[model samples]
Structures are given as structure tokens and as C-alpha cells.
Target: MGRTVDQEVHAAFVEFRAKEDDKVRCVVYFCLSVQCIYCQQIRAKNTSRQKQHLLECPGLRGHPNAPQPSQPAQAAPNGIGPPNGYPGTPNGPTATPSGPSGPGTIPAPNGTLMTNGVNPHATPLQAPLQALQNRAAMATPVQATGPPSAPPSAASRPTPKPKSKNSTSSLPAPPLDDVHAAFVEFRAKEEDKCLSVQCIYCQQVRAKNTSRQRQHLLECPTYLSVMKDSIPANNLLHTFPEGDVARSLQIPAPTLELDFRMSIKMNPKVNVGAGIWGQREWVSFIGGQWAGRWGKGIVLPGGQDTQLVTKDSATNLSASFMLQTVDDPPAFIVVRTDGWLTGAKDVLEKVIDSNMADGVNPGSYKYRVNLSMETGDERYTFLNTLMWIGSGCRRGHEVIFDSFRVN
Candidate 1:
């Protein structure tokens, strides 16, 4: 111990005594501070173990008699140079302490040492010694001045790891069987070839495919929690109309045949009084002729047309009449026609200027009519069950109509 005694051992033993082995050999040696009574009790075999015990020993830390580096000569347990008052070791040159006054002395704060309890004047020799002491002190290790630092705080510590992308903690596993059952139920209820499916959780209709259905079951918020249970049936019902589907499914378009043709003669125009709806007019059917694959017929005389010149400048006509075929036993057919007439004013004026004898230009005007017929005759009963459409035009003083049955 050069300046300070080992803190784990008795200071008096370290300063004054020698090792038992060294005394037996007549070789003088200071007591070994590293081999202390406390170290012996714990069997500490090294300097590090001795220092560790010193740090934990309250008696050494708080003792009033503990060695102080400030009193260098008094605190030196082993002499600074060699054993038993020698100034040098057996294998080394003479050694001396670097303090201002020489070996076994401590320097004061201002790099000067006191001799005989009085301050000494600065001299060249003392100045160099003080510089050497300063360098040696700087090279020494510094002791901790405060308590050990607390454990690192949470904010300063590294963050915990994140969960994996494939983790299933937040989402439940999909219920495949329930989803399949829902699809089956939907298909069974629908009657169309292009099927649609309903979401089991929200009852929303979707395209008939497995991927979309499974996605709905797994990710839909309403059904995610209860995927294992059967979803209640919804009230949605959809069916394609049988007639429309049958019509659409036809491969080759069906052709229509001419059902019949009619030629009617009209009486002179009769002026019906104008009213709020429009100007009214009438034309009486004096007689007519009709023929087709069915036998030819005569249009009866009592038929008449009630016409309206509507405010929109269009002509609307309603006509009810009868026809009697020239068969062995003639059959009488009652006909009702509802129609509209439209034309360019100049063309209609030209036709009117021609006095209804010769018709307007063929493409300049159009007459569209819908017809309904009633008859007790067995031969023409098929007309009652079919749909019919007709187109007609005026030529001279008569109107000719060609009607076809929609197949």
C-alpha cells in the first residue's frame, strides 16, 4: 500500500506488522493488505474479491480510523520503495514518491508540500516533483461519487416485437361448411340458370362463386363472430317469368303469316261538334270486303268511326264494325279497331286539297292500328287466343289493311 491502506483490513496491522513467513526468514515484509482477516473468513483469493468485500463492508466505509490518502506518510501500509527502510528493490533502481517533499509525503492543494508544519517556498526541484505527482494522480482510476444508476426506464428501453402478419388473434377461422350450406340453400330456392348467392351474415345477394361467398363469411363484420351457426333464411324471392324465358330461349326466330286483309269503303265526312277534348268528326262505313287463307268476307254497313282531332294535332279514331264471309253458311265477325293517324302538314294538306279521293304520298303518313275480334264461329276461334298487329293506309276513297298474327 503506497499511500492508502486496504480498507477491508485493520489499519494498524497493515502499517506496523510483517508477514509471518517473511519474519521467519529474517526477510522484512509488511503485512499483506490483500490477505486480510475478512478475506480469510470468506476465503477470497484475489484482489478483485478483496475490493468487492471492501465495497460491501459498512464498517470499513464509515469507520473514523479508516486510512486517508491526504495523510500519505501515516497511511502508507507498505513502504514506497522496498522492504525494511531500503530505498530500492533488489532488481530495480532507487525509487521515490513524486510529492513535493519526497517519499512518504503528500502534496498540498497548490502543488507545494509543508515541512515541519510550515509552508515552503517554491523551488525548481519541488516544481518538477509536483508535476510528476500531478501526472501520476491523473493516471489513477477515479472512484464513483454517488449511488449506482437506476435501471433503464421504459421509454429508453427498446420496444416489444410486433405480431406476425399471419397471426389469427383478431379474426376467427372461417366456417366452410356453413358457407357451403348457405350456397346450397340459395341455389335450391332460385329457379334461373344464372344463379345468385346470398351472404349468410348480411343476407346480401352476390354472384354465384365460392371465393366471394367465402370472403363474405370470413370478413363480413355481421357474420364474423357467428360463422359457425346456420344463418336464418331471408325473405328475398326472385324468379324469371316463364313466358319471357321461353321466348328468349328460342333459337330460330318464328315467322308470322298474314292472317287476313280488309278493304273498307267510307261515307262522306260527318262533322261532329267540337268540344273541350278536341274537334270531333265521324265517317260511316257504308260496306267493305275482306279475304285471306280464310274465305273472303263483306264488311257490314252499320260500322262507323268516331274520330278526334286532338289538341296535340294528332288524329285518334275508334271504330266498331262487323264482317260477313260469303260461305255456304256465312259467319259474322265483330271487329273493333283503335288507331292513330300522323303526317306532315304539307302532305296532309296536299291530300286534303285532293279531296280524300287520292291518298297522301305513301311514306309521308302512317296509320297504326290495334284490332280485337269476337265471333261465335268455330273456324275463326283461333283469332281470339292470338295477338294481332296491323298497318293500313288510304288509297283513293278506301282504306286497305294487312294484319298478321304474332307467333
Candidate 2:
């Protein structure tokens, strides 16, 4: 029942030591929260930078150049309570006590009570060590909600809030303040480097132009910004095909190709062994109006001459021919008329999207032929008919020509 003076002193020292430890742990948690918030602000600024540069950022919304995020603003440095009228920040800002710094926790000059900042989840034995250590620490509790096991870096920033599935997945874009700042920086330098682009309209001779102007023109009437899946404006280079007068036309059509090689194999064979033709006089195609347009051609004679062989009466009168792709596609498609006996002249000009094409003129092409709507009921042999059939013609009247108007 008796205790020595040395034992008594040791017991008292241990009690004092425990009180100080609790304070230290509290300080650590408080500092960590401050750091996390600081990091978030930094990241928000960085996102704004990327968006303004037109760098592929999926998060920036509203505009590509916004500054800080519209979420909660920064907390006070000394962990003071929030100011009145902060619309979205959490409340309980003025509560100086992090966790029940209540009765008899060491008194301090500022009559405010500080909490014991203990993570209640600490093991039972660890709690005593924490309580003793925290006596000197005045750490604040962060109202953070998430996996505590994760490190501060992961835990700091709020996760991208789940978006409505039905809504478009694109973000609203980064804040505009930062975005414009970045955009201004880019614009200042982008103009220094310009490239030459052919004018689709006026068909001016090629010359160097500013890429800056072009980039800025993403909002231009002629300049269309493709969101997704649409044809890229750059894919097409527009210029007048050939003409003395410059036209105010702009045809920015993509390259056109006839996929005969692939389509021929996939489709069923055409049955050509059984058709018949009516007899008529075959004539040379003379240039004249056909299908309401002037066609380029020479008139011979034509009226459906029934024959399988090519002859003056056949080839001369009817100028129907097969096509072969010796060059790039969009061969001009047009329409025209033959002069005499409706002159066995053929027409091709039909598909000239006037809106898209500038300075288009009066001509069409099939086998590079310059006629439209061949008349006189005479037909000429298809020269490279094999390209379409994938084999020799089975019979004279069986194989038919597939025609396309070139641009």
C-alpha cells in the first residue's frame, strides 16, 4: 500500500506526457485538409489552361477557356468559420472546436476551445497514445467524405460527379476566365505562322494566307466546325476546274470514287443474255440541246439500229461507250443533245451540286465523253466493260453500262 517518491513522480510525468501527444495528431489532420484544398485550386487552373490551348481536355465546359471551377471556393487560412452567404460551401465554419476541446483541455489565451482531433477509428490501445500526443496539436477536422485509407492526393479532389446517362457526355467545358487567358496567349503566337490555302470561291491563284485567320474562322459561315463523324472541311481543296471567268462558287466535296472492285464481287451477277432492242437508224451524235441543256458532240445518225457489232452505222451513229478509271474520280456528269436525227450523242452532266461547286460550266463526262442523253436509239460497244462485269460479256445485249456523272 506504500509508494516511493520516485514512483509517484514517474506516474505524474506519464500523465503529462499523454496530454501533449493528442495535440500533435490534430495539427496533422488540419494541415492535410488545407493542402488538399490548395491542390484542387491549382488543378482547376491547369484545366483552364489546357482547354484554352485547344488541347484535348474532356472536362472543360461552358467555354474551353474557363478559369477556376464553379464549385466551393477556398476556406480561410486560420480555419475561420465561413462568411455569410456562401451559397454552396458546407456550414459549421465558425465552430473552433474540431472535436469537443471542452472542459479542462489545456486552457489557452484565446478563449476558444479546440477539439481533440482524434480519428475515433484508431485502435483502442492506439487511442491512448493519440490522446496523449494530441495535447499540444490543434488540428481541425476535415468534413471529407470518402475512403480514408486512400492517400491525400487521391482523396483531395472531388471525383467527377456522375452525369446523367441520357445527357450528352461532353463536359460543360472549363471556366471561361482561364480559357480566354490561354486563348489570348495562343492567338498572339498563332498568327505568326500562316499557311497557303486555295480559295474555293473566286478561284484566285494560290497564295500564302494566315492560319490564324483560318483558325479564328472556325466560327465563319464557310468554315464549319465538325463535332463528330461529319466530313472534315480540310479534306477537300476547292478551286475552279478551268474557266476564263472566275465564279463565286465553292464546292468542297470530298474525293469521289467508284468502288467497282469491291461492289462487283458482293452483288449478284446481272442477267444480260435475254434482252432485245428495236430497230432504228444509227447516226453520229451532233452537238445540240438534250434533256434541256447544250451537249458537246457531233451529229451522225441514230434511231435504234438493232445490231451487236460496231460499225460506222453503229459506232458512228450511237456513241455509247464503257468507262474505265484511268484517273481520280468525280468525272464531270452532264446532259446534252445531238444535232441531227437527235444525233446518237450521249449526255453525262446531271449531278453538279451548284451550291457546293463554284464556277461549274456546261460539260459532262462518262468515258471522258462530252455529250448528254444519247438519242437515235443506237448503242456503241462498252470499251472496258470488263471493269464492271469482272468477266467477258456473255452475250451482246446482256451487258448494260452503268453510268455516273463526274464533277
Candidate 3:
């Protein structure tokens, strides 16, 4: 309390001389002058700035007991006094005190006299630090007359692009030919770069762009409605009568998957001389075995094939047989088929002759048959609704064939 330097402040501060009104001007420390005893330079009489100056001061920095700098306030650091100099001092370097001086005794023409002594060595560090500080202050000219630059206004700033509403933006545009086929193009004005197009279905008019036109067709109410009511040319529904309920159905095309293979053993043909239609012959189906995706079975004997041979040697065949599944309670299925065996006249002659048919190539002639199956067993009843087609080769007394189920 008796005019001692503050340990926290770590600076030499002199008491403020009150005005004639006896009012204190400095809010903090109640002091108006601070002469750094180490650097012997007058600093701005601010508590925080003075502390900052001591830490940055060249003379104080080397002192063992020098205070470390603390976080400073918004005001500038008190490295040196303001540009114009402090009160009682002119616009130049201060008259540094050489030793202890009596209170109120001015040391030089331009220096503030402290109520205490100034160390003689303080001048050596102050000159170099002050010159460096001054140069930095001159290099960066701070504006004191105006407020800081404000941020850009909403209207002045660039607007960010909007995200796409749907992924359709990435779709490649439809071709020009496709666009013209769907929409009728016409020019609104002779000089217009964009031609106008009218949808043939909805008659809606819009700018002619292949992508936009195609997208319009996809979303157009009238066009979608028309498409719903129309049937594609390749659709099997077109085969049904116009007003039939089946015509409105969405049916898939029939596909065939191989079901089984079978070798049918047959007895010798019984020739029936030429009838009103053609040369007729009868052949009886002997025993045979069959296997497929559903089950394995044997072809029951006693089935017959009645054939009519035309003059050109194309043979028409009608056959019927029975199949027995190998289940615990064996299921019996009825199999019936009708097909043709046609080839060169000589080829057919050899095919119809058991002796020569063994030597003929199956590929050299076509023997195809369409078959239908019927069963009373509930376990195998699904076969009753399906149809099969087979391609066969006649080898003397046996016919081997692969049957495909029509899916």
C-alpha cells in the first residue's frame, strides 16, 4: 500500500496526479503514468497493456523475475506510448533517468519524471525494441475513422445451385427419331431456335427437346391412359376376340423346359394297303421306361400307333400309351400324341423299313410330336394341366425321344 510495485503487474507505475477537480482519470490502478523501469520507456497507462509490454519488452524479457505475459484486453498492447506521445512529453524519445531522482524533479526536456529512480542500463534494450515496434506500426496502417467491413448481403452473394428433385435428371435423352414419332414438331415462329411439339395423344404443346418430349410422354395423363387401353402388337392377348375379357389380360409368353426322356419299344408294323386317304399301317407299343424332373416311371405295354404314309413318304402318326410312376402307391398317367415324320422320299422309305431304319441318321429327318398327359392321382395332377412336345428318332424297333414341358 506504500507505493510498492505490484508483483502481478510486474511494472513500475507512478501515482496519478489528480486534476484541479480532484477527479481520477485512470479507471484501473488509479495511475496515469507507467515508466517501465527495465526498458526505461513510457508505456500506455493501461493495466493489461502494461503487463503485455513487460513480457514483450526486450529488457524485462532477460530479467529472471520478469512476469510472463497474460491474455491482453481488446485495446492495443502498450509496447510504446501512443504515436503523438503522452502528456508532459514531446513527440520523440524520452529523457531516460540515469539514477534515483527527487520526487517531482523532471529528468529531461521531453521525458516524464518518475517519483522514483530509473535504472541506467534500461536505455540499452529500449532503443532497439522501440525502433522495431515503430517500424511494425508504420508498415500496417490501421484505419481509425471507419467501422469494420460488413459481410455480403443476401442479394449480393451468389446463390447455391438447387439439388435435383429426382434422379431422372441423369437419364440420357431419348433419340430425335423417337421424339418425332411420339410428338408432332412445328415452329411457333420462323426465327425461333426451339421448335414447338404437340403430343399426338394429349395434344399438349411444348418446346421440342428429345429428352423432355420423352419424359412428357411418361408423365402425360392422356398418353398414359391411351397406353393402358392399347395392346402391343406382339401381345398374345390380341389373338382373343375384341370384346372378350381375355383381351384385357396381361399374359406371359409360353416357355418350354425339358421334362424327360423315354425309349419306346414297338412291335413290327401291320401294313394296311392304301385307303381313301393314304397308305395306312399299324404298330403296337411294347414295354419302355421314362425318367424326368418329377418322377421315374415305366411305359405300360399295349399302346398302339396308327400311321398313314403319304405318297411323298411323309408319315403321320397317332399314338396312345400309359405311364406308371414308381411311388409307393404308384400313379398311372395316360399319354397321347400326334405328330409327323417327314424327310426325303428315300429317307422315309428306309425309316419305315425296320431293317434299314437302324442305319439312318436321326438328324437327316425330323420326327416331332406334341403330347398331352392325364392322371387321376392328386399328387401328380399338375401334369394334367401341362403340355409336352417331343423330338424323336426311329431306330429300327425302338423310338428314343426327349419331351419338353410347355411352361
Candidate 4:
């Protein structure tokens, strides 16, 4: 409805003005306005004070624009031109004031900022004050006894000088990109030898332990187990942040617990399995086993919450969590097994071809099912963020994941 005469819609605006977002924005706008006003006032005062002091200072005495006793105050002398008011002008400081002096300065007649009908910028300093002007024109307090005395300055002031092209301040020395480059070169020398591995480039450098290789047996099984696990692991998107580097420990092939790579290398056909709760659970995995387009990969059944319940149900398996960017190549895959399922590897291959170059769409690939399982101190705030792997050189790739019971 239209408002009646004298009735304004301002009330309607003011009434709804305090909504959460609106009130917050309003406060921000108000603070900004106040700050702008204060800044303008400060700038105005500084500019005005600078011009006034320049008008009466003597240290500026030798300056070409400095006022002289012999010269009658020149006409509206703007800063710099031909003579007195101007740099090389004829009727500059040498010229007599067409009018007598009493006022400090006249305003700039052509510009805005007129006060008392005077163009302040147009005003020239009166030469009569030359006697009173010191290197600094000290506006002093009058002592009842002595002649008008020069007063101490409220603050110390520095004399200004002409700048030259040769002045160090003229051109900032070029940014020290050279110094930065040198730093990079120096750091390169301190890098680990392994970082120079062939066929790969990294934005980071790692440091190697100079000490002779210690017994790697303990971690031997761990490494193979991890790689074996990840070979067919599924990934979760929007679960980890962008640019995050992940690390996981793979359990060795079950039979030869403690070490699988060594076992595999020793025996090309070493059966791998899981051992937990005094039971043995073997895993069957292979790639490119069947005819054309047939699935070829490992199998990992979606973990059951029951795995954490009784010792009998638990499988001595270790899995690491990693994030795969939506639409990116499959970084991992996990096959599900139901009591030695038939054609286990086929499922893995099916999930692979479906996901390869097409990971964004759902059900396109077989994934180790996650029922929105959140365990550790999940970074809930950044759940939807893109995730990437960290530099092994920068962050140690030994991240550990602990299982928590979910109700």
C-alpha cells in the first residue's frame, strides 16, 4: 500500500534493520564511516599546519621560495613557478605587496576551500615577520619581563632537503629476488639425496638419515601391508581439506605377518591373509585376470562395526584414510569379500573401469562403503574442502588412524 502524505517508510526500514545479518552489516558500515571521518580530519590538520609552518620558517630560509626582508610580501604566491611565489617568475618575492600586511595568508582564489572570503593558498608570508622567523618559526609565549622570547618547540623537527635523482631514496633498490634466489640455491645444497629420485619432481626436499640403514624388518611388513591395502581402497571426497597430504600404514600380507614385501619378493606366490583373534583370514587379489573388460583388482569387504566388538569378529587389518578429489583418478580401492566370494577380483575391475576418468558420479565405481563413519577429531569445519597429499619432505608420511565405536 502507498503511504499517506507525511508518512514515511523509514520506520519500516528501521524496524527490520536489526535482523542478524543486517545488524552486523550495519555495525560494520557505521565503524567504517567513523574511521573515514577521523582520517579526513587528521589529513586536513596536517596539510594546514605544514603550509602555515612553511610560511614562517627560516631554516627554509635559503630555499628559493623562502621569504626575504627586502621583498614586500608578493601576491598570491602558489608553491613553485617563476619567482617569489613561483620558481623563476618575474614578480615573485621581489615584488611588493599591492596591499599592506596584517593577515597571515590569503586563500587560493581559484580553488574551493574559501574561509572568511580569503583563498588561504593564495596568501604569501609577510616579509615583516622575517625578523621573528627562526630556522623554525617558533610561535612563542610572551614573558612578562624579557623581549618576546622564542619558545621551546612542542616536538623536535627535522630540516627538509631537496631530493636528487641520485638519492638512495629515489629508487627503492630492486626487490632482492637475487637474495631470494640465493636462499633457494643454498637450501638446495642441504637437501636429501633421495629427493633427487629419477622421473619425479617435488616442490619440497627431504632430508636423509646419514646413519647407516638400521634394521627395517619391523617396518617391512608394515609398508607392504599399507601398499597392499591401498591398492584396492576406496576414497571419500569432501571428507578432507584441499592440498592435504595423507599417510597410512599397510598391514603385511597375512600369512607372513610382520613383513610381506620380503616374502613376496622371496616367493612370487606367497599367500597373503589376515590373522586376528587367533584366526586366519586370507585375501585373494590380482589385476587383469579375466577376459577383456573383466574386473581385475583386490577385494576388501566394507568393514563392519562388529569388527571392533568381539575378538572373534575382528580382523587383523590396517587401513588408512585418504581423500580423492571428486573427478580425479582413483587413488585407492577396497574390494568386499563375503566368505571367499566368487569372482572377487571382477568386482574390483568393474569398479575401476567405471570410475577411471569418471569418479564424480555415484555408484559408478565400487567403493569401500563408508556409512558416514566419523571417528577421530574430524575437521568438521572444513569437511567440504578439497584435499591433497602433504610433502613427505615437509610432513612425515606416518599418519595413524585409530578406530572409535559409533552408536
Candidate 5:
């Protein structure tokens, strides 16, 4: 038939003992079993008492048979226990035993009428035991299962702190000693103002803030590439909007034109020197007068014109002079004239032979001059922004240049 109650109970104890270490052993004494480690003091021969002792024993901490706080000996919240408990223990109330012991009956921990490992007569004690078991289960930490969770998203993380204004200032100052030594660099005399720097690359003299100066050093293609590393990248450099540079650099077309008659008093040419290129002649400008739609102006004296007569059938001449207007508030204009005289015959020889001033001329020569003028006069500041194309024609003791603004 089926196994006896003693055999089943003993089998359960043997199974438990097999899973434990030698530190906590189950010992049999006649009809009872006890824990060897704790049996010396209590001297209990009951298997149920031995199980209770094993639960509380300090030596059984790491043993498999040791009780876990999560899985207590008492029934669960809905009156559920281990599979070895009596019938109806998982379903509802404890099942009543037909006799003192039956096939489906389990022994109680205390010395009382047992039914499915629970005491049928001990109704008052069940509440306290369940409370203890509930507390133990609640105190235990539940383990996670499945794949590990992903890290928090960038948006969820705490925002980074804003960098101080001086953080990027740590980079070494622009290397003024090396390649940029030719550039004019000076700090602003006033506090909190930008430095005045004359960039040799663009040949522009302008005052730029520290941040813009650093950005220029980084963005300028003419600057030495190796020197760019001296400045650290910062938000200020990138704050400028895209295409803003292109828009800022968009130049407008010229709109106005002027033709002026100029009288020139030139000095005798002096041979300066000769080089592999050609001969060089120094021509000094004594004085002149110019009158046009703009106004009447006097070409001040003390200007010099350098002529480079090359062997390649070409002549390049450059003249630097000043022009003073006869306006109510006199304004001074700095003029730089560069010209190219091409063909075999020299430009001065053509002027004399053709008798251009007397209205006797042949269209067999070509001489063109470009004029760059800079003036501080507010009324004529527009001359600084527009490009002018000028062509010179000799007329007697005077020269007439038709200046057309390239529209």
C-alpha cells in the first residue's frame, strides 16, 4: 500500500538533511528526529521541532535547507503552503483529518491535533503565525528577472552645468612671436573693450573682441594651419549663424560716374637703378588741378610716381598722391594710381607724337590706369565703397580721365 506516516515524515527529514551541510545534520532517535547542532540544549526528538530549530539556527545561514525570509513555513496570504502540506491547504481552510492520522494528513509543529501541517484546534495561533509569515515575505527583497534594463536616455539625465566665461580663455594667447609677428597687435586701452589687430592675411585693420579674434584665427585660411591649435573651440566661435558671412560679404554695384580734367606738373625723370626685370625711373609729381561733377580738387605736391619698364613689351607705373577738395569743409583724399602701358611704343612717346592735346591723334596705343581713393570726408565717403574704371586721354598741357563707376 502507501508509505506509513512515520516513513513519509522520516523521508521528508532525510530529504532536507541531504540538501544541508554537515554543520546542521538531522539525527534520528527512535520515533523522532532532531538537528544535531541545536539538539544538545533542547534535546527534542520531534522532526517538526528540528525543522523550527533549523530555521533559527545561526550555523545554517548558507544551507539550502535553511529557511528564507521570503518563503516562510506558514501558509501564504490566501492560505497556501508548500506542496507537502495537507489537502485543501492551497485551496482554502485546512482540511479536517478523518482519524488521529490519515494518508493526506501532515503533522503540526506544536503538540496539537494536526491537519495538513496545521493545527485544526489552534485557531487563535494561526493569525499570529500568518502575520509573522506575511511580515517576513514583505521584508524580503524580490529579485529581478529577464534582460537587464537599458540606461536612462540623455534627456532624462541631469542637465550639464553652464561653462564659465573664462573656461575657453585658458588656451594660450595668439602666437604673436611666430608667423604672426608682422601683424600689428595691441590690447584695447579701455577696460572690457576689444583688441586692435591688423591682420596681415586680409590686410584689414579692425578692432575685434577676444572671441571674434580667436574665431578669425581659426577661420582664416591664410593663417598658418599649425597655429590654429593654440585656440580652444568654444560656443562663441560657433554662435554666428550660417550663411551670415556670405550675406555680410555681398558687395553692391557701383552707380555714379565722373570725368575730371587734370593738369599735371611732372619733374624730370631720374634713373634709379636696373634689375633683372627692367629699368626703373623715378617721376615726382609737383602739383595738378582736377575739376569734375563731384567738385574741384587740387592734386597736392610731394607725391612720387615709380615706372618699371620691363623687357616683356610692357610698362607698369604706380603713383601715390593726395587730393584736397575746395568744398565748404575741405576734405583730403589719398589717391593711389596703378597703370599698365602695353605695346612697343612707350606711353609718353605716343602722347607727344600723336599731338593728342592739339586734337591730332591715331588710335594705335593702349594705356589704362586704375585708381584707388580713400577719403575721410563724410560727403564723399561713397567713393570708398564703389569700384571705378578710369581711362586717361592727353589734351595739350592737361589730361582728362573719364571715371565710370562699375554698376
Candidate 6:
């Protein structure tokens, strides 16, 4: 028959009694020093000690039939001390022993009597045990220690992503409406095309854009004045004498259209120096042509231009001339112009000098004139009522001007 696990473990060590010994000892080691068959640790030849050693030995603990250890008395509440207070001191209160010891005796894990030991000096053990209790009361819990986890490696960390920029596109302009379209005009430039609008009510010109044009209407003085009158008001309102006379504080500015152009032939200037106002001169017209919306004509000769040359060399011109229209019997028209030819002293000297004036840029000086026409012929009755303004440039021996009619 096969031996049980307990019997096999018991047979591994042999028991013997030495000649002068009172206790039995294992022959597997020595009569006085017994060595554990499982763990090979040397122990004294005490039966109870050997038995407890067998229970705790790591080698014997592997046996299938090895005895299971008793659960340690559930730790004292909060684990401050052993169960039932201090195992009885010599004169201290005692507790019931769970082992085969005398009353008030306790067995400790190391096979020592925690109380009532045979040693009469056992009372000193109380101080260390009491110190242990005090240390446990103040002790901090231990955290588990091991190899510190390596800091997350660079490759293992997540990479931060960059934020994208928002790109917004401009919206297209609104379609032009009929009311506003009348104000906007398409104009061509040298490099590109653009739109322009003139507020008919205020005469202020601006680049034509739908939003800006709408804002202009909201703030135009003339438009606002006319709008206020067209709407009825319930409250009493103060009125200005000028505004009451015309329902508007500011009159709508007039518009001008191209009307005519004239080329006047000139004779040499006759200097009449040191007049009451300034140095004076006279320049007479020999012959020229005038073409206009009214009719094409030849300027009758012997017209005179009286000039007042100011201290700054600015010339003021007053001219009188006659025009003959082309017809079976030509009708006669009288022409008179008054204006200034003004610029920097050097520029005006260059402009007036016939020798150096031929190619001088006209933009270097200004030759502006206001003109009036008188005609007795019924065919051109409108000439007496209308007025004209013109800008002119000087050539070697002649002056050319383009005139616009004020409407």
C-alpha cells in the first residue's frame, strides 16, 4: 500500500534518545541539534517547536496533505495590540490562552510564551511590546515600492497638433437697383474700369459701391431736406428764411455738359503798363473758328482782349468778339469772356512767352474763362438765356478752349 503524505513526511526524520538525554531527538541530524528534513534549518530537540516548524517550513508547505495554519487571531481592532490586551504581565491582568499553556498564558508566532514565561525577568518584555504598540499607533502606512516606471518615452507620448487658420472670402456686391443705377456711372480708366456715382441732390461724387451709395443717401443734406418737407409733420417746427423760401437749405448743384470749342487766332500783345490796379495789356484777335452745339461759325476779326497783369504776373483777361454762323445769310452773335490765366510766376512767364510756350504743358498753369453769348436771331434764342464756362490752353500764336454749358 502507498503511504499517506503525512506518514511520508514523518518518516523522513528518525527519532532517537541520547544516553543522558531526557528528550527525544532526530537521528537524521544530531541527538542534541535536530535539523528539519523539509527546510534543513537547525532547531532544538523540542517536540512542540519541531511540530510548529513543520507547519511554517516553506518545503513542507508544498505537500498536498500539509496542515493548514490557524488564522492569526483577527488582528486587534485597528491592529494596535495583540488580542485581548497585553498578554498577562506578572502583575498585569491576564487573558485565556488558546494553547495548552497555564491560565493567562499566550503562545507567540516565534514559539515564545508572550506571558508567564519560565524566566523570572520576563517582565522587561512588556516595555518593548508597549513601544511596538505606540509605534504602530503613530506609524504611517507604507506604499508599495518597485522599479519606478520609466518616464513615458518620447515616442510613446502623443504629439500635439497645430491649429488651422480660418480663411474668409469676401462676398460679392449686391445687384444695382434702378433708383441707385441712375446715380452710378461706369467709367473707363487707363488700366482698369471702375464705377462712379454723383449724388444729384448734394453734388458730392464718390466711388460707386452699393453699400456706400446707400449710406450717402441717408446723410445727403439736400435729399434729407426735400424728404422732410415731402412728409407731413405733426409738431411745430422752426424754419430758416432761406430754407422756407425754397423748401431746401441748399440748392441742388447744377450739372454741366460739353457745349462748344473755339480756336482764336492772336496778334502780338500790346503792353499798357502801370494801370490803376496793375500793369495792363491788350491782345487783339485776328481770326478764328468756333464750332458748337448751336452752330459752326467763323469768328469775325478785330476782336480785343484787355488783360490786367497782377503784381504776381497773373493775367486777368476780358475779351470781346463776334461770331458769324454759316447760313445763306449768316447771322451775327456777340461773344464776351472774362477770366484769369494764373500760375506760378515762372510757369506763367513761360506760358505767356510765345517763343517758349508752344510745348509747355497746359497743366502747368490755368486758363479759365466764363462766357456769355448774345444773338438777336430768333433761330438761336436760347443763347441769350444760357451761360458757359471754358478751359483753354495756349499754343505759339493761338488759344484753344473747350466750353461747357451750365444746365
Which candidate leads in TM-score?
Answer: 3
Q: Provide the clash count, candidate 3.
A: 0
Model 6 lDDT per residue over 288-319, tens place: 99897879989999999999998898999999
- After TM-score superposition, the amount by which residue 172's alpha carbon in candidate 3 deviates from its true location, in angstroms, is 24
For model 3, residues 117-227, the per-residue Cα lDDT tens digits are 232223333333333333333454322221133223223533322323342222234456756788765543332233455677765655455665677665655655454
Q: Better model by TM-score, 1 or 6? A: 6
Candidate 1: tens digits of C-alpha lDDT, residues 1-407: 22234432232211111223332211111112232332223221345444455555554455543334323233234635333222332333323343456544554445545553222432222333334444444454433121133222323533323323353323344467766876433321212223445454565554466655665555555664353222222112643343332222213345667888999988876878788888898888989899887678799998998988765556787999998989779888888889887686656545433275264666777776878888889987866766567788776657788887667
Kindly list the per-residue Cα lDDT of model 2 for residues 76-157, writing each as its tens digit.
6777634532222133232222345553243222333336644343323223334544552444433422222322332353
Quick one: best lDDT, which candidate? 3
Query: Judged by lDDT relative to the true structure, which candidate is superior, 3 or 5?
Result: 3
Q: Kindly list the per-residue Cα lDDT of model 4 for residues 254-357, writing each as its tens digit.
A: 22111000000001122333445443332222221111111122222222211111232322232222222222332232212111111234332332232331
Per-residue lDDT over 1-407 for candidate 5, one digit per residue giving the tens place of the 0 to 100 score: 22223223332232111111223322331112232332223333575664455556565455444343333346658877545433343335553333356533333433354323445543332323333333434453423121133222223533323324453322234543433453465432222123345556654444433454454554444553333332232123563343334222223344655656566666666888897778897878788988776788898988887888776546687989888999877899888878876654554465533244345342445556777789888998987866666676555544456665565
**Colliding residue pairs in candidate 6:** none
Poorest stretch of ten by lDDT in candidate 6: 165-174
The Cα error of candidate 4 at residue 75, in Å, is: 16
Q: State the local distance difference test value for candidate 2.
A: 0.26
- Candidates 2 and 4 compared by lDDT, better number: 2
lDDT of each: 0.53, 0.26, 0.64, 0.23, 0.50, 0.62
Comparing 5 and 6 on lDDT, the stronger one: 6
Better of 1 and 2 by lDDT: 1
- Give TM per candidate: 0.38, 0.19, 0.43, 0.17, 0.34, 0.42
In model 5, where do residues sit more than 4 Å from their true spots? 1-256, 346-362, 394-399
RMSD of each: 33.8, 23.4, 27.0, 27.0, 27.3, 36.3
